[model samples]
Target chain A: MQSLIVDLGERSYPIYIGQNILCEALIKPFIKGNQVMVVTNDTIAPLYLDHLLAHLSGLSVDVTVLPDGESYKDLTHLNLIFDNLLKNKHNRTTTLIALGGGVVGDMTGFAAASYQRGVDFIQIPTTVLSQVDSSVGGKTGVNHPLGKNMIGAFYQPQLVVADISVFATLPDRELSAGIAEVIKYGLIYDYSFFCWLEENIERLVARDADILMQAIHRSCEIKAEVVAQDEKEAGIRAWLNLGHTFGHAIETHQGYGNWLHGEAVAAGTMMALSLSVQMGWISIEDMDRVRRLFEKANLPVTPPKNMSSNDFIDLMSVDKKVLNGQLRLVLLKTLGEAVVTADYSKEKLMDVLSA
Target chain B: MQSLIVDLGERSYPIYIGQNILCEALIKPFIKGNQVMVVTNDTIAPLYLDHLLAHLSGLSVDVTVLPDGESYKDLTHLNLIFDNLLKNKHNRTTTLIALGGGVVGDMTGFAAASYQRGVDFIQIPTTVLSQVDSSVGGKTGVNHPLGKNMIGAFYQPQLVVADISVFATLPDRELSAGIAEVIKYGLIYDYSFFCWLEENIERLVARDADILMQAIHRSCEIKAEVVAQDEKEAGIRAWLNLGHTFGHAIETHQGYGNWLHGEAVAAGTMMALSLSVQMGWISIEDMDRVRRLFEKANLPVTPPKNMSSNDFIDLMSVDKKVLNGQLRLVLLKTLGEAVVTADYSKEKLMDVLSA
Candidate 1:
């Protein structure tokens, strides 16, 4: 198993990844077991909750499942987790284990962070989107009315167990969604990873074990390094948000959970690349590479036809990245290099939108 | 005006104290007017919200009046604040300002810290308990089923406005509770401050302007220094929890929000002294002086008749100070110095209890 530590001082924790690694022993150190709460959603619980619960059989584990969707990543859905914990009388020592994809992971992580101030929780990420992204960083939270992850904490999980076996159960649509985040790492900071993704897109789409492991491992390394530098999403951590500024706008406009996070990011990344090309930061060839690789991964490369530039800009304003009402866009110079800049002119933004 | 700065790198903020210091010019910079939410308990809003809101006259201010008391300082209460922030279309730029005492301050601070991931919040602390303790620490959170502040964060407020005039309307009982924390500062880290408190307890109980200011300033200094050393409550910052270990048990056993926090803390301080003397860390005469001072200030100097030693032990087991189910007590070695030690024997605890 490969592990990465999110160095957040007292809040530091470890993220572990490998095939067939979700057994109890890996996460026992973090579980305060008189009462344990497992938070997941319908989509995940039916598929993998039993395998996860099998580990908690000896312990007094309470499982609570919410409807699976990004739209449910809000306070209303968060309360469902809390309602169970409260009903079960789960205390500070009651550990929360999030056993699902990013939507479930983010919501569960947030539920742990906010329930009774905070509680211990571990992540058992089932989807690639989660194993490589949400599970690694201490970033956990639900979406606010204004934006996704608008309500959250840089709360690290006590332990993160990413088991590749769970991914076989993921639907094709979900599998493709997860790939968007995997591709994000290459576009933001690792040129070689981008090229690697370009070469291995077919295998990854086919769920080739060796290729998938390599992608998850490398994505986590890049993420772990960025998170180490800015645990609080203050600076370099924002780089991990490549495609997210526009991706969030898409997700919000599409009404969260409607568009899988990875799909939104896939299209958002294409726009970022186009914007980058318009800004003269990257050649058109770079944009084409991103589009082709994303397409090969079965990720959407275009915005929904109904989306207007005006609507996109309005939706983008609510993102956490927009500071003092100025919309900040995360555009790419090339794969493996991303910058969060609002230096682009409206003329450029319009050109990309009008494209 | 007296000000203390909690230098927590990017999270650092200021705590200002004085009479009628609520000028718009003083508060506007910290007020993110895109949306401003003021959280206070029912008891405080009737007494001070109109007066406070009058200051933010030109800004878009929204007031949320929660039920009064510490029992209300739960996720149930915090969600009310978060819900209000969103239901009103408040965005990332929205600022939250906590009003009222520690309960309100802590809940609001947590609300601000978790709302939209985090938002800027200012503290208009009306009660002395908050100004000297909760208001300065950025330790924002609500109570948990098993522990006091078991769920919380070191979320700093943008500015802490301690308008002394709010003291004029304070209930005599509540004022005495605030003094408990004021005296706590003197007992924990500053012998000179203890001497100061010993001499000025009477003037403070009667709410003398000059003496109160001195007490508030000195308390802020001690807290500010400890917070500076350990912003996240990892090391020496634990010392600032002087009477809290015992006090929380009392509050919890009695049912939270039952006794005023200061009243319970006042008794807890006496317990700390008794424990200190039992361990030979504090002198008998010093213990007597501690009791005498609490009496003079009209604060409780003994644990309530209702709670047994087992009750205290059970309640304290979940305290933030308690590690791995073992209790860590903060004992006063000298009138103004405190230490958190796990060395107390069960026999010693029984002896103190039976004594």
Candidate 2:
């Protein structure tokens, strides 16, 4: 087992990565109270809820299974979790365990954050996208009809248990989607890691457990460091959303769950690279390498064909990155570096869109 | 003008209490962004929205008026604020100003807490209940159908401006409701303040600016100290909910807004005192004195005659104060001191309910 700590002072918790460690003893210490509620979606509840129940068997555990999809990540579904909690009479001491992918993790984390003003919860992220990114950062929320992740909280979890064995059951496309975030670490901060990803792309796609473990571990380490410095995203944390600005536009336009979050991010990263190349900040060869790496991982390499430049601008305008009505984009300075600023010209942005 | 600071380290904010001090100069320093969205209810928007707009004339300000009453403090109303924000393309830099009473303040605070994961907001509480209690501490959220304040966050405000002049427009019942919180500070922590209230109840009832200012200032001070010690209600802060357990049941049973929050709290405090008397923790005379003080302030002294004991027990059982499935009550130790415990006898509790 590999372990890492998100050093957020008192709000910090440990992340444990391994295969088949979802047994009771490993999860017992993190259960702060006797009342435990497990929040998962229908897709995952059938696959792993029983395994989780085996660990929580001796204690009082209730389960709330929401419909499985990004589309289901809204206030209506969020209320189901709260309804279950209220019905079961869960208290402040109750511990909520999010036992699915990013959607489940986001819902449970938020429910825990607001339930009784806040409660402790554990993340058992089953998807690579969640294990590597969303689960580690304490970023939990639902999407609004107008935008993605528009409603949520930065509530950290007591523990995140990422069992690598679950990847064997992940659909091929979902596995590929998760790799987009894994690739994000390289494009934004680690040049050598970007190179490493280029070399190891085939092994990751083949579900090679050793290579997959390496990817999840490295992604979490990068994320933990960024979150520690700016947990609230006041400064450098914005860099973590490099592909998110355009990606959220795609998600919002295409409607959530129609396109996977990581898939949209993959395409959005490509657009960001095109803008970077237009600015002469990164060479076309580097941009190609980035695109080829994503292509190798089976991720999308362009924005959806139907989305117009005006649509992108309109959708992106509502982004949280908008500061004083100016859209701030996170662009690559080089293969392993990125910068968040509103300095790019409209002409350059238009060129990338027109292309 | 009188000012007191809630010393919560990085989250600290000031509470300014005075008459007709809602001018631009007093509020401008706290506006972090050029875009300001003031969230007010229908009743208050017609009354004070223009006055607030006058102070914010130069900035890009948007006004969202929600329906008035506690029943409107739900997710649907909260989404109205979000819709206005997204429609106006308000960014993370935009500041939300909650410009009504407790319902508006609570909804706006929760919206700011969750919008874009988090944003800065200032409180311009127009009611004594909000100025004295909800606005000072960071306990911001909306209610769920199952329970009051069941869904929310502990998000603080940037500043709190309590213009005492607004009290002149307050209905007699609302003014009396506000005094319930004023009396709470004394009942929970300060004996001398309780005696002071006994002496000046008539002046406060008449909305004497000088006496009302004194009451609001002291309440903020006592609340700030308790909150600074335990911002998240891990310990001593629970004492602040002396009458809230029974009170929340009333709110939940009667439906939110049927009985005002302060009114429910006033009657609930009497129940807690009755329990204290049964426990031999306080004399019957002290309980009667407490009841008389609330009556003097025109606050409720007894639980609504229609609510059954079983309903109260069932409702209170789901309170946030319940731990390990046991209900914890905040009971008076003597006159001013209070203790939160589950150690009371079941028979004695039954006796109080039966009586």
Which regions in candidate 2 have their CA more than 4 angstroms from the true location? none
Q: Per-residue lDDT for B152-242 in model 1, tens only?
A: 6668889998889998888888888888888788788888888878888778888889888888888888888898888766578888777
Measured on C-alpha atoms, candidate 1 has an lDDT of 0.81
Q: What does the lDDT read for residue A93 in candidate 2? A: 95
Candidate 2, residue A82: how far the Cα is off, in Å: 0.5
CA RMSD per model (angstroms):
4.3, 1.0
Question: What value of lDDT does candidate 2 attain over all alpha carbons?
Answer: 0.91
Worst 10 residues of 2 chain B by lDDT: B346-355
**What are the DockQ scores of the candidates, in order?**
0.29, 0.87
Q: State the displacement of the C-alpha of residue B16, model 2, in Å, after optimal TM-score superposition.
A: 0.7
lDDT of 2 by residue, A141-222 (tens): 9888888888899999999999999887899899999999999999998999998999999999999889999999999999
**Per-residue CA lDDT of candidate 1, range A1-355, in tens?**
7777767688778877788887767777788646788888887878888888887767788999888777778766777786677556565667888888887888888788766566788888888889898898877887766667767886778888877888878899988898999888988998888888888999999999989888988888888888888876777888888778778888888888788889998988888888888888899888888888888888889988888988886777666776655677888766678888777887888877666
Q: Across residues B1-355, which tens digit of lDDT does each residue of candidate 2 receive?
A: 9999999999999889999999999889888789999999889988899989999978999999999999999888899999898889888888999998999999999999999888989999999999999998899999988899999999999999999988778899998898999999999999999999999999999888999999999999999999999999989999999899999999999999999999999999998999999899999998988888999999988899898889888898889888897899999999999999999998888777666
TM-score for the B chain of model 1: 0.96
